[model samples]
Target: MPELNGILVHPDCRHFRGDIPCRPNKENGYLCADCPVYAPVQERILLIKLGAIGDVIRTTPLLRRLRREYPAAKITWLTLTPAILPADAVDEILKLDLASTLHLQAREFDLLFNLDKDKEACALHDTIRAKQKFGYTLHPEYGVAWPGNDLANHKFLTGVFDQLSLQNQKPYPQEIFELCGYEFQGEEYVFDTHQDKGYSWNALPIGKPRVGLNTGCGDRWTTRLWSDEKWISLIEQLQQAGYAPVLLGGAAEDERNLRLNAATGATYLGHFPLEQFINLLYQMDVIVTQVTMAMHISIALQKPTVLMNNIFNAYEFDLYGRGQIVQPDRQCVCFYRGTCKLGTSCMEDLPADKVFRAVQASVNA
Candidate 1:
């Protein structure tokens, strides 16, 4: 039994390899007592958030509360998309690989929070050693992820039709804080840079309010997508109003960006690396996009955003009052489906003029 960073490095220590903390600075006599690399962990905490990308980013508000509650605790996070989590936010980031999964199951934690509702994450939560467990856990007989507390039930209910219809007014972060015995204090997302690219922007036109159009919503929920013609019309409106319309998207939207750029003469700043893209996003005066990761990013950056939402409930998002959610006049019959069964999609009913007005309002606000 050796001490690493003031915490006993037992066999259950996730940082321990054999009898010592893994990668300990040998200059500190290998006891990890004086090691600068590893801090003397006062508490062991684990957070599990796997991806749909946007959800992982949105969950970042919890980090501020966690750090506030356990100031000196050693925080370790498990995520599929580690890039989204800030480097300074957690002591260690473990990707959902075989080794990390096995290590987590073997380790003991002072506090553990598994917010994911996935079966695999919930199953692992049941096995991990922890003094206190918050968020979702595995159900014994059904083998599905179940809420650990009453507050968490609110979040669970929103997933199904019946519970969601109840129209819970609580914001996501507020409900998430209830599971951990805390209150949300308007904490923002901690999107730390992966690397400072120091990239310069000469493409953007000068002396005009930059309006970014995040074109792609990824492949998951096709119902969230707006028509290209609608986007073109919006671009034209922005240009007529003397606002610079910039097209933003990932590699998946390359062809689309080119087409939109050619059609509307908007600046198409093609897909950039994540960090560079973030830097670019910072330059925007207002970002107009579908309910995608870009919307979360815009909100995280504190930029005024106009989010075009159709399928997902608008109430679920907590934008900190920095953004506006524009919904179609007609109710969306397709909730979470990939395709719109109706001949006229709900998103089409959302005219370009309506979205342009939202952009104008967001920019002015």
Candidate 2:
């Protein structure tokens, strides 16, 4: 503890920041000695989950369980996409960078969970000072990522071998929870919906249930991409069935989305920044998307979703009872392959009619 004007400062207070004035002191001009909201930090917990934005977003459920388990703990999360994380759930959100890495190395934690298998992430986990560690760490001798404990072995094994991953039935949230020695009970994702930002989509059609069609699966996973014909068919069917079909994607799908909009007369509001994109997604009643970031966002929004799958294991996703998984009628042999092994993708076998039926069921539900 330090003293300012002969008044002892509570350094371990949750709101105390050594570098600058704390929020209470800045806003209300309250000194630490007489601050009414001085809550002591019981434990320091660090969570390291680095990018592939969707993964970062999905990992938010752990915060809920952590808050319940360590009510007075100061939780710090290190992630590449810090903007997506719910601010209210975390005490500190640090972007994964050189400065953050240095800061973390100098800090000690009561509990540390490194949920990423990346070499840097594991290396940090190995070097960091923590009383209890979970998830993965670097193998000091082998210089490779390894499970921190027995609980993480399942997730580690699944990641290394596609066959093991396909056989595993545990959803991602459950695996992460188990890694940290906790049982997951359908905890919802903690997301910043950006509702307070006052973003609106006035052009979005009204009256009918808005069904968002997320058209892109990113450049890496081309196997997850359904044919443009299927998308057009689904859009036409939705329009015929008296539903508003909205096309959603980022820059990659801009040209294709425009083509689709021109051909089918579906509404394409064009891509937006992350927060505004989330707000746009917030308007959808039901969303039809591949296992991309949009799928995670839709699930976080608690909107009914029809997830189209081909490459990844369906068991890996927990839709939180808000959606259903519609895989191709023909089993995809590619497993997690980025490109289709067969000249024709199994996604071709997944009929537009099947997807439409799933969307219809979701909307009606």
Candidate 3:
């Protein structure tokens, strides 16, 4: 066999937890003896993250990797507001809300990871007791319990695990599969009623290859959109090519989604539940969106997606992959804050022809 090099350490050379003396350190430039994550095997785990439906969805893969590495461990997630709740690995969701008494009630966990930037998240993480505590390495003023708000100048999935171990961490991740052992089977996320509103997915139809369309982007970033005529022209082409387009958005998009659906006679499903919306997306042929979380969902599901962004640089692709970026590639306009400097003219420039070919090829592929 080839050289299988390793190291030996003193019994006193333990980590912060003084329990997990070491595992073969595969991160940074250091060995296990130098690592700070020295907790022994944990029985329960917790992960906290908030906002942006797409980001929450994309983070799902971390759970899968964790489960594969450690099966049979009980895992939980700490979530905020309306994020894509991971049903597969998480045994529970620690809701960060006004009515939640978890932190105040002195809930003890083996480990809890927070992955948000807001200061309130830091306070809660510090209070939650565990054998080992860790979070995204942030400023000292934030007052978290452990080491690492570790994500920094990283790309794509790197922003999750390795970045959390290196760069600037906002908080620790909330993935439940980090424990060493378990057997679980379920969908990526489960959509259910929100606080007894009597909502259900039973009424809506579940179709194959579900495709979601983020027709309305934030008003400030109008330069990132494809024009009305361009959208209509492209959807028409999709219909002609034997695919149906399902228009999606939030309550803020009612007027636009309604008008566009009327104008082109497309299927308009606006401002639905994020989980229900994701269920619909999982049933589509493709998702065509702006630089929104919906696009992230498509990436998480490994579904074909087309993102209409303003640029083709590595940064934009970091948020939205190049494979799903809109046609013609680069944007002539530079305005990206609240509204386009050149009005909606930048979006108007992209004709349906360019996107149509890409759509057909992806659909066929």
Top TM-score prediction, candidate number: 2
Please provide, for model 3 over 212-235, each residue's C-alpha lDDT reduced to its tens digit, 9 standing for 90 to 100: 567777665555666667778877
How should the candidates be ordered by lDDT, best one leading?
Answer: 2, 1, 3
Per-residue C-alpha lDDT of model 1 across residues 53-76, encoded as one tens digit per residue:
778888889889888877778789
The lDDT leader among the candidates is: 2
Tell me the tens digit of each residue's lDDT in model 2 across 1-365: 78878988999999989899999999999998789999999999999999788999889999899999999999999999888988788999999899999999999999999999999999999889999999898888998999988999999999999889999899999999999899999999998878889876889999998999999989887888888899999999999999999999999989989999999999999999999999899999999999999999999998999999988888999998877899999989998788788888899999999999998888887
> How well does candidate 3 score on lDDT at residue 229?
72
TM-score of 2: 0.98
lDDT against the true structure, each candidate: 0.81, 0.92, 0.55
- lDDT computed for candidate 2: 0.92
Q: Hey, what RMSD does candidate 2 come out at?
A: 1.0
Clashes of each: 1, 0, 39
Deviation from native of the Cα of residue 200 in model 2, angstroms? 2.6
Residue 270 miss distance in model 2 (angstroms): 0.8
**By the TM-score metric, which is better: model 1 or model 3?**
1
TM-score for each prediction? Answer: 0.88, 0.98, 0.64
